[model samples]
Target: MSFYLTALLQGLCFSGIALGIYISMKIFNIPDITTDGSYTLGGVVTAVLLTHHVSGYLILPAVIIAGWIAGGMTGLIHTKLKINPLLAGILVMTALYSVNLTVMGRSNLPLVSISSIFTSLTVLADPNQNTGLILLVFVIVITLLIGYLLKTDFGIAMRATGNSESMIRALGVNTERMKIIGLALANALTAVSGYLITQFQGFADMNMGIGIVIVGLGSVIVAETLINWLRITSVWISLILVLAGAIIFQLILALTLSIGVDANLLKLVTAVFVLLIVSLPRLNRVKD
Candidate 1:
């Protein structure tokens, strides 16, 4: 039971990254690979600040800003220099590896003795339960806020820019600016996931963000299927389903481990799982 509970909490920590990927890939149709680096960047920033006695709340904005800058750089490279979006994201992600190392000044940072945002919360009686509650609250708040934003005028513009770039551009919308904002917002959300995971796990490792994009992509793909089957039209419901997808993905992994799968094969299993999810829909279309 405890193992399943831990997986649920970890899934909630990853919900933010799923949301980020939904924005970048689903909304903007951009294959932004900056997630790998910006995620580590967030963890690095959090570890450095926490170790230096910085307030946990303050670290949130700092991480967001750092991620925003990283994402903005990718957007600028793609939009201004006429580079491919994939290549631009690759460049920024590669650069962020060195930047994260410089920020941490080490390959890993332990936070066992340092205070964390989870430690400061007094609402939960069990210390083990505090992290889960806090993560739930964070995910709920962010989901609602993003849902609300998607209904706003600017958010509609962003969606329009993604759907029909030339049409929105002709209508006086700055498509380039919208793309930049979308990417920045996506990366900011991804950074928040990194921040939460680092605090929850009690340490930050430079390699923690490796191949994390697959997790986010898997979650989004799952959510997309749910949205279609459920005929979900409300943005809020769609967002909730996306978060649920993250939790479900983690649960699947937990189940796999419980069934005695080798830990060394976990990454391979994850890749195969995501590949199946991505291919199934296309297969159905072909059958139809």
Candidate 2:
């Protein structure tokens, strides 16, 4: 029971990343790989700030800014330099590795003695429940905020720019600016996930974001299937499904581990799982 609870909490921590991926891949149709670096950037920034006695709340905006800058760099490279989006993301992600290491000044930083956002929250009487509640609150707030934004005029413009760049550009929308803003927003959310996970796990490792994109992608893919099947039209409901997908993904992983899967094969399993999700829809279309 405790193991399943832990997985649920972990899913909440990762919800932000899933939302981020949904924006970048589903909305903007951009394969933004900057998530890998920006995620660790968030953790590194949080760990460094916490160790230096910075307030936990103060770290949120700082991590968001850091992630925005990283994402904006990718956007600029792709738009201004006329580079491929994938390559631009790859460049930024690779650069972020060195930037994260430099920021931490070490390969890993443990936060056992440092205060965290979880430690400061006093909402729940039980310490065990406090962390989960706090994470749930954060995820809900962020998801609702994002859902609201997606319904605004600018948000509609962003969606249009993604669906038909030339058409939006012809309509006088600055498609380049929209892409930059969208990527920045996506990465900011991804950073939030990194921040939460670092606090939850009590440590930040330089390699922590490795293959993290797969987790987010898996969650988004899962949500997409549910959205299609249910014909979900409401923005809020779509957002909730994405969050639920993250939790479900973690639960599946927990079940797999409980069934005695080798820890060393976890990554392989994740890859196969995502592949199946990605391919199943296409196979169904073929059968139809």
Candidate 3:
């Protein structure tokens, strides 16, 4: 309800996007254009279940599993069929539109009186107190846990799979498995974010996921640019950049919305942001 609390919720939105981008781009190197669809899939799953009186905790995992399947489908198509990774993602994303439509049984799903994670976790809080702060805390904790997971051996293998699948394979690692696993983890997180987004925003449009991939990629690129500019080279630094990028992305969106920016233009703005981040190194001619 308050300004600060709204700002925190906005920040958490970006944090979710950043974490999704990190998993798809950084860990998997899969260039997952399918995220946009998987995102909506999560929302649709949550909304459908919530509409059917599913428990909040149960819906969380359901949406996550739904996301995993969506992403893993892309991985399977790419690995088994040898489709171009980009094209594979596109195909999966296309299929998800219909799937999302089916999940909602038409177009969009609404959470009229669903109990969200925040509502359940805030029983002790003042009825008027800010719940966004509590929700933001959980988002931060999830982000930190994801970062820690990426540091473990499994995470190392996942990262390595992104850069050089052959190298990881030669090292006795199952690169294909890692790719599948990475997509599963990444999309599951996206799904959870979508689930949270639906609960937080109180509605889920079947098409709500459009442009989300670009937004997530933009945040990741912006974060990477910031850290690379500073010559930061640690995994921790990358994680920080991911979080920072997401926060900054949301701030930019909020600012744009406050200035009465056209809703459609926001998609263009996201594209431009990604272009800027992707092109900066070449423009400066000093990428490495």
Candidate 4:
């Protein structure tokens, strides 16, 4: 039960990444691999600030700004330099590795000795339960904010830019500008995951963001599956489904571990699981 509970907390921590991916991949139709780098950047920034005795709430803006800059760089590279979006993301992600290391001044920074945002809350007696409750609130607020954004005029334009770039451009919408802004927003959200996860795990490592985009991809794909199956057109309902997908993805992994799968093979399991999720829909259509 405790194990499953921990997974639930982790899924909540990862809500930012799922939403980020939904923006980049679902909204903008860009794979935007900058997620791996910006995520570590968030954790790096959070760790540095916390060790300096900065207030937890104060660190959020810093983290978001840092993420925004990283994402903006990728957008600029892709739009201004005429680079492929994937390559631009890869370039920024690679650069962020060194940036994260320089920010940390080491390979790892431990936060267990210091206070965390989770520690500040005292509503629940059990620390785990308290953390879970706080995370639930955090996820809800973020989801609501995103849902509202997607229903606005700018948001509609952003979605249209993705759905029909040529058509929107015909209407005088600068498709390139939209792509840049969309990527920037996506990575900023991704960085928040790093902020939350570093505090949750009580440490920040330079390598923490390695291949992390897969988690977001898996979650978004899971949500995408449901969105298709239910024909969900409401943006708010789709956002809620994305949150559910993140939780469900983590729970599946937890179940795998509980059934005695080798911990070292977990990545392999994740890969296979994602492949199945990605393939299943196509297989169903083919059968019909």
Tell me the tens digit of each residue's lDDT in model 4 across 223-260.
99999999999899899999999999999999999999
| Candidate 1 structure, TM-score to reference | 0.98
Q: Give the TM-score of candidate 4.
A: 0.98
lDDT of 3 at 207: 82
lDDT of 3 by residue, 164-260 (tens): 8889899999887788777877788777778877877888998888888876787788887887789887887787788777777777766766678
Clashing pairs in 3: none
Error of 4 at 95 (Å): 0.2
- The better-scoring model by lDDT among 3 and 4 is 4
The lDDT per prediction is 0.92, 0.93, 0.78, 0.93
After superposing candidate 4 on the true structure, give the runs of residues whose Cα lies further than 4 Å from its correct spot.
Answer: none
Each candidate structure's TM-score, on Cα atoms with residue i matched to residue i, is 0.98, 0.98, 0.90, 0.98
- Single out the weakest 10-residue window by summed lDDT for candidate 3: 1-10
Model 2 lDDT vs. the true structure? 0.93
Residues 1-288, candidate 2: write the lDDT tens digits: 776888899999999899999999988999999999999999999999999999989999999999899989999999999999999999999999999999999999999878898998688888779998899889989988899899999999999988899999999999999999999999999999999999999999999999999999999999999999999988889899999999999998888888999988989989999999999999999999
Residues 9-104 of candidate 1: C-alpha lDDT, one tens digit per residue: 999999989999999998899999999998889999999999999989999999999989988999999999999999999999999999999889
Error of 3 at 158 (Å): 1.3
